[model samples]
Target: MQKGKVLSLEDRIPKIKEHRRRKANRRLIFLLTLFFLLIACVVYIQSPLSQINQIVVYGNDLVTTKDILSVSSLKKGENIWKINKEQAKKNLMAIPEVKKAEVRMEFPNNIVINIKEYSPIAQIVSEKEFLPVLENGTILNKSTLLADAPLLINFKTGTYLEELVAQLKEFPSEILNAVSEIHYDPKETDKYHIYLFMNDGFEISATIPTLAAKMIHYPSIASQLDSKVKGVINLEVGSFFKAYDEEEEKSEGEEER
Candidate 1:
């Protein structure tokens, strides 16, 4: 083959220089892009845009949003990325009413907290003031009473009241709603005695120990009785019905006269 057209040193030197220049230009472009990216990241971390701007609470009723925020120690303008989600949740769970809690970051500058609270089974009536009693045997401070919740009277914070609360915990919603009031009428012979006044104009007498087991069948018992006559449905020892003395006396007088 004819001597391959040999590139003169002058031509080869210019080509090599051009190649080096292109490689250097590419490296400079890469370094400049990296430098700007790092600066942008630093600016973002130091700016208010990275701080919490809003906090939203969900699934709360008995416990107020302000209480949750106070417990969590999460404040607006705090660095959202630095918050410990698990710790915040633990703080919220410490509340007597809060049964479950969850905390999460909503990106950019928002924090979202979700909570679930224990339901109030009854309202404890103390000197005409009503206090909500939770299913877990916790008595809240005097507050608005729910219309459907049964009023508990003459109940002190003691073993008897705790036992009664435990029994009421297992009551079906329908049966529990039918109860208008529960009076702790203990006697020397039976310290666990209780009287339940039903919304359907009937009364129930039961001991705290056997309350849930016997009262689960309240619907059936009430169904078998005459609705017009208001009487005590005693579930103590055995089930029976006894009309109030005034009602019986009225009936007797009506018959005699």
Candidate 2:
């Protein structure tokens, strides 16, 4: 048979129209589906169903959750998108004890706040109360007496404990770990008397700047000490050590000798 050269123009016109109609329908259906999806997303994001239903706080001990939430300006049931994260973080950090603040949002209704509070390295005695002092030189809440860390004495005069506290910051991590107590007397400006109570009964005498250097080798120095001797290991002048008796006066024999 003659292949009929395909179809005539009249027959091909109807098929062409049908194909165009089907293509238009498909495009319309696709557009409608995309439009509905966009609407649904907008509704879900704006509705209260997607708003924050829970507020979680972490890494905070001294500061209460309520205190942080109150200052944060982030309330429950508020839209997550409406909350100003940067402003909330700034407000939380404004609190004196708060060292760092982090604010984050979890989808489907959750707000998480992570906080880092400053730790007290020493106690500052002011008037009748002893206040906890942070590493940043800021004074925190008042504490009665703490046996864990050392108490800084005589911080009023020009020989205030600020110098010692500043020096402590530069100390090596190993030395800082071994240190138990640091004491200062303002009357003697150039000298600092540090009593390091080791796990053993030995006490270490460390002068201001020398303390940091000596403490680096504390373990080795401690190993050389006689177990029977219970006295001060003075690291005041260079590397020389002077072992004083328990009952010996602090400065009595130095001037006499």
Candidate 3:
């Protein structure tokens, strides 16, 4: 084996000093980088860049964006990091129309609020004012300007109304839109009996229990009838059409002439 190389203490001391200097330099550089990073973080946190410059709302209807922001209490100048997302969400959920709410912070300074609002399935006619009825069967106290939805007459907040709303929830959009008005025409035998006035000049008699199952066939039933003929379509028992008595009488008189 070749003899190992040996150095004098004076030579080894310089080499050790070089290694220590390099290590010290590396540690100094790391500390400086860390200090700069911390300072940058503090400056960023205190700057306007950390503030919410814009607040955007999505998936909101029936509840206006301004109203949603008011409820959330999230302001444009508020720091995005300081906002309590869960609290904002809870506040949004308190709105009667809001079914779900989500809050998130976007990069650089944007706050986005996403909310899902309950849709109005029908409007109740109360004292000449139309109140929107949500899908969950809660009738709003505030009157609405929208007149396209079906008008429900003489409906109280009860199981009957709840059941009716639930039944209407499952109705196809076309079929639901065809309905213009619904009257709670209860009978001694059937408390759920309802009278529906259709947009196509036809009336429908159905019970709440069988409304969804039977009304799905209304389009096909109405298609078979004469468009000019006015009548009532009874869906309570079986699907059938019956012309108005006046129309039948007029037809008979014309036949005699």
Local accuracy by lDDT, each model? 0.92, 0.74, 0.92
lDDT of candidate 2 over 68-148, digit per residue (tens): 999999988887888899999999999888999999988778999999988766676777777777667777664656555
lDDT of 3: 0.92
Scored against the true structure, residue 118 in model 1 reaches a CA lDDT of 94
Q: Number of the top candidate by TM-score?
A: 3
TM-scores vs. true structure, each candidate: 0.83, 0.77, 0.85
Candidate 1: clashing pairs of residues: none
Q: Give candidate 3's total backbone clashes.
A: 0
- In model 1, how large is the Cα lDDT of residue 122? 93
Q: Candidate 3: misplaced stretches above 4 Å?
A: 1-21, 246-257
**Model 2 clashes, total count:** 0
Tens-digit per-residue lDDT, 66-101, candidate 1: 989999999999987888999999899899999999
| Candidate order by decreasing TM-score | 3, 1, 2
lDDT of 3 by residue, 136-175 (tens): 8888888995666899999988999999999999999988
Off by over 4 Å in 2: 1-8, 125-130, 144-147, 156-160, 170-177, 187-199, 246-257
Ordered list by lDDT, greatest first: 3, 1, 2
lDDT (Cα, 0-100) at 86 in candidate 3: 98
